[model samples]
Target chain A: MENVIKIRGLTKNYGKNRGVIDVNLDVAKGDVFGFLGPNGAGKSTTIRSMLGFLRFDEGSISILGMDSVRDHEKILRDVGYMPSEAWFYDTMRVSEVIKYAADVRGLDCAQEAAKLCERLKVDTHKKIKELSLGNRKKVSIVCAMQHRPKLFIFDEPTSGLDPLMQRNFFNLIDEYVRDGATCVLSTHVLSEVNRYCRHAAIMRDGRLMMLEDTNIDEDAFLKYYMDEEEM
Target chain B: MRAVFVREIRLNMKQLIIWSLTVGILGLVCILMYDSMQGDMKSMADMFSQMGAFSDAFGMSTLSIATVEGFFATEVGTVHGLGGAMFAAILAIGIISKEEDGHTGEFLLSLPISRRRVVAAKGGCVLVCLAAFSCVCALFYALGFVMLGEDIPFSKLAVFMAMQLLMNIEISAICFFISGVSPKINIGAGLGVALICYVYDLVGRVVPDMKDYLFMGPYSYANASEIFSGADIAVAGVAVGLVITVVAYVSTFVCFDRRDLAS
Candidate 1:
C-alpha cells in the first residue's frame, strides 16, 4: 500500500527547549493510525511539522506524494486538519465560520457541513463565543470533515467532547474511512487507540518509543504505558 | 485570497465605522464653531503669531486663524490627522499578529492558501479601510463648509486629503510590518509610533535645525497648515514616505513567511 504520510529524521528545537528529535513516522493509505503520547510528548510538534505549520530543523515531510513545504497549498487541498485547540473568530456565527473554511478551499461543502452539524448537535446560528467547549469542538469537526478530504489529521480531537459526542465522532470517522479515506488520530487516550486504530505509535520525551499493532495482547500494551509513567 | 480579503474587511467593518465617524464628526463640529470664534481667534491669532516657536509649531505664525480656511487648517486638520493616524496604526498593528495571538492562525493557515497570499489579502484590506476613512472625513468637512456657506478650498483641500491618505498608508505599513514580526498584538507600541511621528513633525516645524530632516516623519507632507498657506507641498518628504511604506510592506511579507507561528 502507498504511504499517506512519510517523515524521515524529523527534528525541531525551540531554542533551549526540545520540540521533537529524530522522529520518523509513516501512515499507510486507508489505515487508521494512532499517534499515542502523553501531554508533552511532542505529538503536536510533529503533527504541526507534517502540516508545514512549523519549520523542522532537519529532514523532510512528504504527504500525498508531495513535499510538505514546496507543495504545502496543494497538499492541504485534500487534507482535513483539526487542531488540538478549537479557536476561531469569536464574533462569527458557527455557520459563517464553516462557510469561510469551505470558501477558502473553493469547494461547496454545504451538504456535508449540514449533515455533520446535525449529527454533532451544533448550533449554527450562535456566535462562536457563545458556544460551549464541546460545541466548539463539534464545529471544528464539521469544518474539518465537511470537504470529504482524502486524509484526516486530528490532533487531540476528542478533548472537549462528551462521551456520546465522542462516539458520534468515531462513527463519523468510520463512515469516512469506509469510503477509503485515511486518518491519523493523535491522542493520549489508550482506549480510543485500542478500539479505533489498526496500528499505533507511542511517543515519549520527544521520541518514538514503540510502533506496534493494536491487536497485541492487552497486558503488553498496558505494561508499555505503565512503564513510561513509572519513569 | 478573495475569501481572506472579504473576511478581513468584514471583521474590521465595525472598527472602520467607529473611527471614521469619530474623526469626521469632530472635524465637522470644529468647522461649525469657527464662525462664532472668529472675533476671539482674530485677537488670539495676533498674539499667537508673535508667540515664537509655539505659533510656528501649529502654523499660526504663517496662517491667520481668523478666516474659515485658516480655522479648518489649524483645528480640524489636527483632529483628523491625529485621529486618522491612530486608527491606521490600530487597524494594521494586529492584522497579522492577532492570528497567532488569538490562535486563529492554526485554522487560517490550514486552508489551501499560501502565507504570502494571506499577507497580501490583509494588506489590501488595510488600504480599503484607510481609503474609506479618508473619504468619509472629507465628506464631513465638505458638509461643514456647505452648512457655513463658505467656499471650499478645493485645490488645497484635495492636496491635504491626498497627503493625509499617503501618511496613513505609511503609518499602517510600519505597523503591519511590526505585526508580522511580533508574536502578539501590541496596541501600545502602535499608538506610540503614531504619537512619535506626530511629535517629530511638530518639533521639526518649530526647530530650525530639525526642519531639514522632517521628511523622515510621515506627518511632514500631510501638514494642513502648510498646504493651506500655499507653501510648496513637501514633494521630497512624500517620496521618502512612499519608499519607506514599500520597504516596510516587503519586509513584513519576508518576516511573516519565515517565522514559526505559535500553536
Candidate 2:
C-alpha cells in the first residue's frame, strides 16, 4: 500500500528544549495509525509540523504525496484535522460554526453535518459558549467529518467526550475507515489503540521508542507507560 | 477568501456599530450645540484667535468658531478625526493576533486556505469597516446641518472626509502589520500609536520648526481647520501616508506567511 504521510529526519526545537529529534514516520493509505505519547512528549508538535502550522528546524514532510510547506493548501483539501481542544467563535451558533467550516472548504456538507449532529446528539441552535466540553468536542467532530475527506488527523480527539460519545466517535471513525479512508489518531489512550489501531507508535521524550502492530498484549503497552512513570 | 472575508465582517459587526455610533453621536451633538453657543462663541472666537500658540494648534487663528462652519471644523472635526484614528487602530491591531490569542487560529489556519489569503481577507474587512464607519458618521454630520438649516459645505466636507479615510487607512495598515508580528492582542500599543500621532500633529503646528516635517504623521493632511479654511490639501503628506500604508500592508502578508502559528 502507498503511504499517505511520510516524514524524514523531522526535528523541531524551542530554544534549549527538545521538540522532536531526528524523527521519521509513515502512515500507509487505509491504515488506522495510532501515535501514542504522554503530555509534552511532542506528539502535537510532530502533528503540527505535518500540517504546515509550524516551521521545523530541519525536516521534510509530505502528506498525500504533496510537500507540507509548499503544497499545504492542496493537502488540506483532502485532509480532515481536529485539534485537541475545540475553540471556536464563542458567539456563533453550533450550526453556524459547522457552516463556516464547510464554507471554507467550498463544500455543501449540510446533509452530512446534519447526520453527524444527529448521531453525536449536538444541539445546533446553542451558541458555542453555551455548550459543555463534550458538546463542543462533538461539534468539532462533526466539522471534521462532515466533508468526508480521504484522511483524518485527530489529536486527543476523545479527551472531553463522555463514554457514550467516545463510543459514537469510534464508531464514526470505523465507518470512515471501512470506506477506505486513512486515519492518524494521536492520543495517550492505550485501549483506543488496542481496540481500533492496526499499527501504533509509542513516543517518549521527543523520540519514537517503538512502532509495532496492535496485536501486542495490553501488558506490553502498559510497560511503556510504566517505564516513563518510573523514570 | 470570500468565506473568510464574510466571516470576519460578521464577527466584527458589533464592534463596527458601537465605534461608529459613539463617534457619530458625539459629532452630531456638538453640531447641534452650535446654535445655543453662538453668542458666547462669537466673543470666544475673537479671544481664541488671539491666543497665539494655542490658537494655532487648534486652528482658531485660521477658522473662527462663531460661525457654524468654523464650529464644525474645530469641534466636530477634532472629535471625528481622533475617534476614527483610534477606532481604526483598535480594530486592525487585534484582528490577526486575536486568532492566536483566542486559540481560534488552529481552527482557521487548518482550513484549505493559505495564510496570504487569510491576511488579504482580513485586510478587506478592515477597509470595509472603516469605510462604513466614515459613511455613518458623515451622515450624522449631514443630519445636524439639515436641522440647523446651514449650508452643508459639501466640497470641503468631502475633502476632509476623504483625507480622514486615508489617514485612518494609514493608521490601520500600520496596526495590521503590528498585529501580524505580535503573538497577543495589544490594545494599549494600538491606542498609543493613534494618540502619539495626534499629539505629533498638534505640536508640529505650534512649533514652527516641526511644521515642515509634519507629513511624517498621518494627521497632517487630515487637519479639519486647514481643509475648511480653503487651504490646499497637503499632497506630500497624502502621498507619504499612501506609501506607508502600502509598505505596512505588504509587510503583514510577508511576515504572517512565515510565522509559526501557535496551536
Candidate 3:
C-alpha cells in the first residue's frame, strides 16, 4: 500500500507548555491506523498539527505526497476531518450546517448527508443549539463524511455517540477502509483499536512510545500500559 | 469563500435588522423633535452655549442646534455616531473571534479552505451589512426631512450618509484587525475602541490645542458641522478615514494569515 500520510520530527509548542514534540507517524493507503493515547498525551495536538491547524516548529508533514501546510487546501480536497470536541454554528439548523460544509467543499452531498442523518437518527430541522451533545456529534459525523473523501481523520469521534450509533459509525468507517480509503482514528479506547486496527501507535507525554501490529504484540500492548500505570 | 460569506450573513441577519431599525427610528425621532425645538432656537442655542462642556463632549458644540440639519447632527447624529461605531466594532470582532470563543474554530479551520479565504469572506460580509445599514439610515433620514417640509438637498444627504458609513467602516476595520490577531476575545476590544473614540472626540472639541489633532479621532472626521457647512463633506477627513481603513484591513489580512488559531 502507498503511504497516505508521512510525518517526521514534528514539534509544536504552546508558550513553553508541551503541545507535541518530535512526533513521527505514517499511515498507508487502506490502513485503519489507530492513534492511541491517554488523556493529555498530545494526541489532539499531533492530529491538529497534521491537519495544518497548528504550525509545527520543526519537521515536515505530507499527505498524499503533498505538503500538509503549504498544500493544505489541496490535501483537504480529499480529506474528511472530525474533531474530538464537535462544535458548530449554534444558530444554524443541522441540515443547513451540513449543507454549508458540503457547499464550501464543492461537493454534492445532499443524498449522502440525508442518508447519514437518517442512520444517525439526527433531526435535520433542529438548530444546533437545540440539539443534545450526542445529536451534535451526529451532525459533525455527517458533515465530515458526507463528501466521502479518500482519507478520514477522526479525533476521539465516538465520545458522545451512543453504543449502537458508535457501532454504526465504526461500521461506516470500516466500509470505507475496506474500499481502499485510509483512516486515522485517534482514541484512548484500547478495545476499539484491538478490534478494528491492524497496527497502532501509542503516545504518552507528547511522545510516541510504541507502534506495533495489534495481533502480534497484543500481550506486550497490555503489559506496557499496565506497567506505565504502576509507574 | 462564498459559502462562508452566505453563512455569516444568515447568522447575523437578526442583529443587522435590529441595528437598521434602531438607526431608522432615531432619524425619525430627531426630525419630529425639530418642530418643537425650532421655535425656541435662540434660547436653546444660548442654553447649549452655557453648557459648553456638555455640548462639546457629545458633539453638540459645532453649529446652532436650531437648524434642521444642525439638530439632526447634534441630536440624531450623536446617537448614530456612537451606535454605529459600537455596532461596527461588535460586527468586526464577532466575525473571527466568535468561532474560537464558541469552540468552532477547529471545525472551521479544518475545512478544505485556506484561513485567508475565511477571513476575506468575513470581511466581505461585514462590508455588505455595513453598506446596507448606512443606506437604510439615509433613506429614513431623507424621508423624515421631506415629511416635515425641510429643504435638504439630496446630494447633501447622500454625502452625509456616505461619511457616516466611511467612519463606521474605519472603526469596524480597527476592531476586525484586533479580532484577527487575538487568540481569545470578549466585548472588551469592541467596546474599548468605541469608548476611546467618544472620549477622544470630546477632548478634541473642548481643548483648542487638540483641535489640530482632532483628525486622529473618527468623530471629528465625521463632524456634523463640517458636513452641513458649505464644505458639504470633509474631503481631508474622508481621505484620512480611507487610509486608516485600508491600513487596518491590510494588517488584519497579514496577521490572520500567520496567527496560530487557538481551539
Candidate 2: which stretches are off by over 4 Å? A215-231
Q: Residue B196 in candidate 2 has what lDDT?
A: 95
* Residue range B115-234, candidate 2, lDDT tens digits: 999999999999999999999999999999998999898999889889999999999999999999998999999999999999999999999999899999999999999999999999
Q: What residue runs in model 3 are displaced by over 4 Å at the alpha carbon?
A: A215-229, B46-62, B232-236
Candidate 2, residue B128: Cα displacement in angstroms equals 0.2
- Cα TM-score of candidate 1: 0.97
Fnat score for model 3: 0.86
DockQ scores for all predicted structures = 0.88, 0.88, 0.84
Reference-based lDDT, each prediction: 0.92, 0.92, 0.83
Error of 3 at B242 (Å): 2.2
Give lDDT: candidate 1, residue A47. Answer: 90
**Interface RMSD of the candidates, in order:** 0.5, 0.5, 0.9
Candidate 2 lDDT at B250 equals: 96
Across residues B1-263, which tens digit of lDDT does each residue of candidate 1 receive?
A: 99999999999999999999999999999999987897798788898889898898898888998889989999998999999999999999999999999999999999999999999999999999999999999999999999999988889888999999999999999999999999899999999999999999999988989988998899999999899999998899999999999999999999999989898
Over A1-231, each residue of candidate 2 has an lDDT whose tens digit, in order, gives 899999999999988988999889988999999998778888999999988888999989999899999899999999899999999999999999999999999999999999999999999999999998889889999988999989999999999899999999999999998998999999878888888999988778898755657766767766766654574
